[model samples]
Target: MLGEERASATRIRLLRDVGMLFESADVGWLLSERGAATSPSLDELYRGLVRALTDLAALPPCETDSGDLPASAYARVPDVAREVCDVLRVLLGRLAGAEAQAASSPASARAVVRALAAPLCVFAATHVQEQPWSSPESRSAASQLLEAAVRASGSVSVAEFLCGGTPSGEQPGALSAVLRLLRPQMTKESWKRNQATKFVFSWILTRVGRPWLADHLDHVFASSLLISDDYRTENKVLGVKCLQHIVVNVPAADLRQYNRAQVLYHALYNHLYTPEAQLVEVVLPCLLDLLSVLEKPCGSTEMTRRTNRYDQVLRLVLTHMEMEYKLALRRVYARNLAVFAHRMGVVMIRHLKRLERVIVGYLEVSDSPGEQSRLSILDVLEVVLQNTWPRVQSRLGALVRALLKLMCDVTADSGLCSPVAREELLDKATRCLLLLDRYSEGQIRA
Candidate 1:
């Protein structure tokens, strides 16, 4: 049996050889070293080589003799690249451990977190599909490392991260590197597209004119599958909500030049017609939010040859004004329609009597929507009537009369079985009518 002393010496000698090779900066040797360290006695040597390669990767951009080599050349080989990531999980643990000792080594702790950004990103992006699943321990370790890095670099707020931008104080090249690796990971069911939208959102959330950074910016946000293209694999609800978040974060004028942008506005347009009731609640408000941001007279010949995606944008919303199937979806339908009418202002509501009818129809006693759902629809009604009161004034006389009659009836059913639930529903309806009456000049029409 090899004594512990002998194993330690063997580990030391093998590590020296690995160090010398790294000094030469000839990456071709990493494969050979990993292959040679298979013997149980030399297990530490394999671990050493992994760390050495990670350090080599995280070093500031060095000018090696291989000028012709692509920046991504090291990762082009799948086997070698994957070993680097396996080692990366180890480094993440160390970084977390160091950061945990805040009083002892703060500067060194911060440095590890900062230097780690590039290597972690590069390893994550390399042939990710071909890589073996990182063990549970490794996954937990990586998460800890990320949290530590985020804590150390307090420059980026949590909100900014969701918008697809890095923390404020990050070095430019490192920030771009991180986003590139983050893009393809967001489409899985756990796409966290809610937070996932940030990888791209950070780029154009402000007005972007940098053509040099355009390629990176485009890859991360404008062309990402999670936006609307990768619906085949993504959870549509999560993706739509993330899309809504990005729309909120993106600056108006910066995203304006292309309001009907493919997969941006175009994707939402396509989803509206598809029978996904789940998306009805979220996508409609976002579509209207988008129109409020768009340049006027979209797609006209006089405009800058715009895709006029906004034309489809308006046409689609006006066409599908209601969702009649589920109580929850109907409530969502009312909410989205109200927000749209309110945002478009009276000029729009005054012209589209059909929209007002769609918004008001959810209140009918015969539809029988659930108690909680009915209350939610009422809340939307109050906002819609409040925001569009001037336009709705002359139009909703008979509807007001029906609401008054519903208030006086003691046996209102609307499909709710529990008496307590029915009471709650009626209470909500009464409040909605009162708010509508507030703006009715003390005499509701009819």
Candidate 2:
């Protein structure tokens, strides 16, 4: 009935009628011998579900830039699609629930789930590509329905289906096919499509477990790299996040196999060269996590062997910080610098020359209205002092001068800062000064 040549509204009404009938019927009764004569057979209900899904999938692309569809048609498309999805969700939920309890055996339940995988995956992918037509509500319904369908399959996870079908190779899963369909849409010109594609990939990544992800690392890794390499900063940040997920999900041995870890390392490292503070901010933490997994201690000489990757990243960050003049980027670098310093520990002394210049340069200027960069730099200095006080003592004179100058500068701009923030800076500076005095044997006072 849904596949007939009828208006979208008529088809939706038919779907709603089917949904209402199912919603009113109890699953156990529907599957019971007594109600079996009155209620639709499971096979008949499954066919109706497929038809409704087909009606949904047959909607024209709602792209504004594409087809010359009337504006009225475009406006009506999402409403019609959302309604059909709502009905399909209800119908599928009832059918799946009934099938789980009604199946003669576990194999039968698994067979039904496997049969539904292709259609469900296609439908979910349609909703996930939500920018042009599907509403958020419809997309959410699709997710719930997909989950329900998988849960009914018992013992087989969505991840298992995605990684490979059924272990016996009965049929190839939809994940690879979905990726292929979405990849062409991830172009620079079609940003909405690109965004939608990423969302779909994110959904897949979330459902997949480590064992599954490890087997299909290339698919996940390649998609992340593609997004990270996009010209857009937002996509780049999301791509980094996806990579972070992969780092945590895939085991170290697999990540290091065929130098996959190094490839990821350089990808993130290349992102740091972009001047966008937002992208840089996300890349740093992801890099930190990836580094932990990629690099490991070999033996008793672990301490002596320098973490060259960390040092390389630190050097580049310090270089950028030294030359950075923008308040936002400086603030970002300063904030992250403290984190790196803490992680580096005494390894921070490796970049003392650049670090000193950055510290002095950052302190010389006033970040009015909040002085967040100065506050973060103060934190970095504190970490430096705590970890490398012996090396820091030699540079105490310049550091003390910078600290005193910052204190006087903060006082000079008293109106720029709230009383609370001003006091905090003063307190932090005083602590740094006191540390210098203590470490330098009153050299700061001198």
Candidate 3:
């Protein structure tokens, strides 16, 4: 190891040389270094290990290098990697130990963990998919080490470390290989039982983005589905978020391949049955984005289907709004319902009867002093009038009655609505009334 006074570059070069030696050394030499009293310091050791594994990872295996290769030939190549794994195992243990003391010295422990995290994660990402470590036992160890390291360093740092470096763009396939190592830990049981594991999987899904994710759809989809299928609300939310990222970043054609889009559609649609307000709030926007990808409009075969994706979602959303009584959730439903109405375009007329009921009912009830639910419902009303004005004429009486009553309620509840909010509500209600009058050709009374 270089003295503290030595230049950092000199020390890095020395450690890198030690790493290069591992690339060609025998098992006996590797073992001797592992046991030597003059072993490198943690920083030097990690630097050396990463350098060695990175070289090995870049090597293409010989054509004859099968598992059946003579033990002598195979041992010489993988032994170096095995020794590095040994050193890493100890390093991971140290990180876990430091984290255990976090309560007493959070800043100090965090510094230690962060210092070692990126390099170790780089090592894992490098050789985790190469020969020897790609085996189940080796990969499991690598995944556990990753979980602990990421938990200690926090997801943001580890994600940046893995995805931000120079090699990410140059060797994206290598980066995607890291996903295979992480899969065991992102299983349904692990996702539900381990919050940190879920975070790791979810963050990776977003952080890696489209480039690396495009070639690795199976891993991305499986982990996301497992998270979504979990019983925990937080896990489900993470799953939804991951799904959203996938929907946006992955090619629409690829997502549609092999009924993958249908699988995602059913998964999100089922979540609407959930009573969890938080889950529903996220699911609606994601569903909206995904519906566009899953279905193409304008005389496509999808339009020929008996029930299209938009109608399926709208029917379910209206069903929830009709039965829902919680003001917070009603706000969520009303807010999203407006977008659905707009996206549905003139086709929104098909759901008019049920949509009219939800709009009227939502306006009648006060939700908070802000009247967010009623305001959102009013937006829905305007969208309805704008898109389906001719059909709205028959429903003007019911709609007008609701709007007048809402304005009266907003006016009467002076204490509930701040002056600003009250005026805003009144203004929006009056505008809806104007649209109603225009649609009615002055046939409607105030």
Clashes of each: 6, 0, 0
Q: Rate the local accuracy (lDDT) of all candidates.
A: 0.48, 0.72, 0.68
Query: Model 1, 315-411: lDDT tens per residue?
Result: 5555554545556555556556545444444334333466555545655533343444445555556665665677656765755765666555426
Instruction: Tell me the deviation in Å of residue 88 in model 2.
Output: 2.3
lDDT of 3 by residue, 1-446 (tens): 34422533444455456545545454233322245678764445545555564454222333331212233333333333434454455544444454566334444444445455545564555345434324444445555656666655444354444554343464122235456546665664443332234554564566666555777788888888877887778768978999999998888999899999899999999999989989998999999989988877623544654668888889889998999999889999999998887777778888899999999889888876788888898889888889889898789889989988878877776787778778888888899998888888887754
Q: What is the per-residue lDDT of model 2 for residues 172-197, given as tens digits with 9 covering 90 to 100?
A: 55566555555565554553432245
- Which pairs of residues have clashing backbones in candidate 2? none
Cα deviation at 148, candidate 1, in Å, is 4.5
The list of candidate 1 runs beyond 4 A from truth reads 1-115, 119-139, 148-173, 182-216, 225-227, 231-242, 258-263, 295-315, 365-373, 387-397, 408-428, 431-446
Q: Could you tell me every candidate's TM-score relative to the true structure?
A: 0.55, 0.76, 0.65
Candidates 1 and 3, the one with greater TM-score:
3
Clashing pairs in 1: 156-167, 162-198, 163-198, 163-202, 164-198, 164-199
Query: How well does model 2 score by local distance difference test?
Result: 0.72
| CA lDDT for candidate 3 | 0.68
